[model samples]
Target: MPETRSYTLDIESLDLDGQGIAHHDGKVVFVDGALTGERVVARVTRRKPSYDKAQAETILRASAQRTTPPCPHFGVCGGCAMQHLDVAAQMAVKQRALEDALAHLGKVRPDQILPAMQGPAWGYRHRARLSVRLVPKKGGVLVGFRERRSSYVADIRECRVLPPHVSALLLPLRGLVGGLSRPDRIPQIEVAVGDQATALCLRHLEPLTDADLRRLRDFGEQHRVVWWLQPKGPETAHPLDPAQVDALAYALPAYGLRMHYRPADFTQVNPFINQALIARALTLLAVRPEDRVADLFCGLGNFSLPLATQARRVVGIEGSETLVARAREDAARQGLADRTEFTKLNLFEVDAEWLRGLGYFDRMLIDPPREGAFAVAQALAALAPAERPRRVVYVSCNPATLARDAGYLHHVGGWVLKAAGAVNMFPHTAHVESIAVFEPSATAA
Candidate 1:
């Protein structure tokens, strides 16, 4: 139990949740956006005997790491939190955040901490889902991210993290939506990037008129972007017409491979970071010429195709039958079908015995959803020492779940945490994309 009373406190540390944790009068205090080495007076927002939350309204002295934010809607827009902090400082804090989480929650630490991975701070986000609103009381349509911790959309015109073209389209999108018959009915706008062009998917609640269709088509031609309209479910999305303009695709230069994906599919938003992450994960996996590798939750064969170049065979498992068939087609197109295998399985609820009957492999790499591949990881951990893969490379988007799963493998599976590090996959934001390597204890030393 903690002391219950109103007391002014100073922030000591920043948690991974983007909140600063400190102590006052023997009670834990969490202050929003208050960094270390800075003194601030905050009011208690919530009180539990053990811990309390506070809101910092003023900063008497700001940290040197803090800087002027470019976006006017910095605090109001929920898209990013650390934009005010210097880039290097932000990465350092994130590194500490991961370290703290592991030490405090997992009761363990990796033997080695890999250098944190950093990338372009601005114009790095290649993917985003923007929200739309028509607030009659306020004005016309609101075309941007939702307000910080609120359902109301932020009244924004430019985003520093988005690519220039995407940023430039916001104001125009607002005007265009204002022109729509039911602008408020339009809920989402999904953006995806392919190798050659950018694509936008408009999710509307009602059918569009011929006039509305003409405007969207005209906008597509003028901006040189592909326009897709989603009237119902995800499967219902399609191009405005027969000719697909500005098809988004990305290239993997190391393998001379080019792959195409729809905007809604899972692809790394930062090309540079994605490539670097793939290279790092492969190095950790250490694929051998004769080694067979398993890539669980592999989407569109991003890691599978790259693994084929080094491994004797690469097996990719995904939950979507559509994605599985598409991966198979991609493997065939690349003429790597002989080296790559595709399967559809619910990674979250896997059949351990059924997977064991399939044979074995030397290495495994997984890039699962935000859920963190709990079942798949647990099953892999349960395999006999002789049957289990020797090494694993995990790329994760959520820190808490990744740490939780990491604990299970290290504590229960007789494995050693070799190395864990952070990647600036989503800069200026609270999202931390990280990769970790685990190895058999005997080989770890």
Candidate 2:
């Protein structure tokens, strides 16, 4: 191989992936393991016409925001990208990302920037999907997240992002898998840590023998965890023995609510941050006691039930039938069934006419997936002043989509972007969760 070229570069900014950006001979270079305002020696790993990818070899000047990563597998594990940066700095980067997306992609800016919502950085991940691989060369069974960019699993003995009790099971889990009847048949382990108990869903391609079941039982007994086996899809996942495990649920004590979820369901990964986000979203929504509210793209009644506690009526619209059913059940369980209604609808395909059918809502809360709520935004924009909700609180996972939708709501729909801010849901990752509030423009006809 030809000698690799090395460049001394000054890191200028951070990309969405938390990589450092530097200019090299008029081309953009993305440097891994480097921070903004730092001068580093980087080795060109891949070159492109417009941009290049590099790995930082040495830091000539360290940034004040830089801090030692708490996790030993920080650089190697793709599970987290911003672990090396201080928690405050991580929030700053995410805030910048949200602002940039809103200004550049959405062409709208919030009138006020809400203070960043924060929670515990370490041991905050309540849910995670760990990759399992039987690599004889590496050892026996290697279990952890995939390597930074490779498909290979990182040999992680402990994960700082996981709760201490769950993290302690990593090595034992490796042994458990390695001794299974068909070690190679297992692909991944889905971890869901609830308030009362920890559950692990093992995805195995082949059947487990009686011996394998006994071993799993013994592991669960020893570790005080519940074992769920998934032979096929997520729907097929069930506890090995239902009597041995407590139902998986997380408590939102402030609301006196316990939200039940399955291992495969899409609940917020950080329970603490999720509680904070819900409170912030609701406060931004400013629901009134007599108001009829709409929770669009609501999952598992995460927000709807809380809204129902205050609002006279709450209608939740979701694309997933399963989630809708679960949300409805949760509403009934919470005694909010009389106030809340959930319906299955692909919010992505909705238009103005369809939104009108739901009647007028005094306030609306939107918590969309990464795709954001473009169709719903358009529908809301197209509604007449009398038909539109006076205020909207949009909770978004993708800042770009939120910005785009916010821009349309402001520039096209005659709405005002009231306030926006980042929520540090995944503190050690580049994932930006944001909440933006909107209201009809004062001058709109």
Candidate 3:
């Protein structure tokens, strides 16, 4: 139990969640809406044996990095966490957090820290899942992200992270949904924006009436957006009229590539940063024309296709059959199928033997989910020096997991941490994306 009374505390640092950390009576306290080096009066919201959670009520002293949030629904909406902090400060904090994780958790340090990759601070999100709820007391319906620290949907007319056109559709979408046969039945709307068109996938619990279908068509026509209906799982989602929809795709002009993907398929949320990341990853890989490369956990061949353009042969391994099939199609469309191979395999279940059975790779690219490719790291560490890839470039969405795997690679596998840096994939949020390069140590080789 926590005391209802407020207490004055000094914020020492910012945690990974962007909450300020302080010490009170020998217990750690996490204070929301506080910045590092700020003294604030906070009231405890929840308590645990080792720590307490609080919300800052009054700022006795404000930090230089603190700024007024641009979004009106900043605190209530869970979409953006560090909007109150200056954009430059946000990137600096993320970089520091990455270095700290590498040093403290991994007990390894990069020989060189690459410059933090950055891009636009607003209207950069290309993919998002908006929540929907019907509340008669407050309003007819609410459509936006979930509230901070809550499951309830936040009432927002516009989103700062979404594109200007999509943000403008928020109110229209609310009306569009409220007029539906069962507004409450539609629990979520997934947004996917491509270079040419935008898509809105409506997840309904029950079958929609002809009137509801007509409303969707009218909205789509007026807004110039596609409507996808999902009565059940994500796979069930299909465009109401595929003929009217433009093929959802993004272009990598540098590689002369245009990658197509379904609305439900996994793609980077930030297209600007995705392009920069791919260029950086390829540079770090130093792919030679004769090199045989392997892309682990490749989704939709984002990296494999690009690598295929440079490498003699590129092998992509993924866990999902659907993603593998799509990757193959994309490779064929890009005219890289002859040089690229797509395989469906659970990388998480692989070991040294399984990895060795696949033969040798000159270099490898790893773009895994937040779980951080621990099993793959273990397999690489278990492999003989001759069997291991000569070089590896890892792209991660989680700093902590990247550090853990970096530790295993450096400490146990005799790999050198050549370079690592943070990527600002999601601006104004606590999320930290990073890239690292590793090579076998001279002694081990």
Give per-model CA RMSD.
2.9, 1.4, 1.4
Error of model 3, residue 330, in angstroms: 1.3
Quality of model 2 by C-alpha lDDT: 0.90
Best by lDDT: 3
- List the candidate numbers ranked by TM-score, top first: 2, 3, 1
Q: Estimated TM-score per prediction? A: 0.93, 0.97, 0.97
Tens digit per residue, CA lDDT, model 2, 8-82: 999999886879999988889999999999999999999777889999999999999999898888888898998
Cα lDDT tens digits, model 3, 352-438, are: 899898899999999999999989998888888888888999999998999999999999989999999999999999899999999
Report the poorest 10 consecutive residues by lDDT, candidate 2. 1-10
List where candidate 2 sits over 4 angstroms from the true fold.
1-3, 244-246
For model 1, residues 75-109, the per-residue Cα lDDT tens digits are 88999888777888888877777777677776669
Regions more than 4 Å wrong, model 1: 1-8, 43-53, 443-445
Candidate 3 has its poorest 10 consecutive residues by lDDT at 242-251
Q: Which residue pairs does candidate 2 place in steric collision?
A: none
Q: For model 1, what is the error of residue 373's alpha carbon versus the real structure, in angstroms, after optimal superposition?
A: 1.9
lDDT of each: 0.83, 0.90, 0.92
Report the candidate with higher TM-score, 1 versus 3: 3
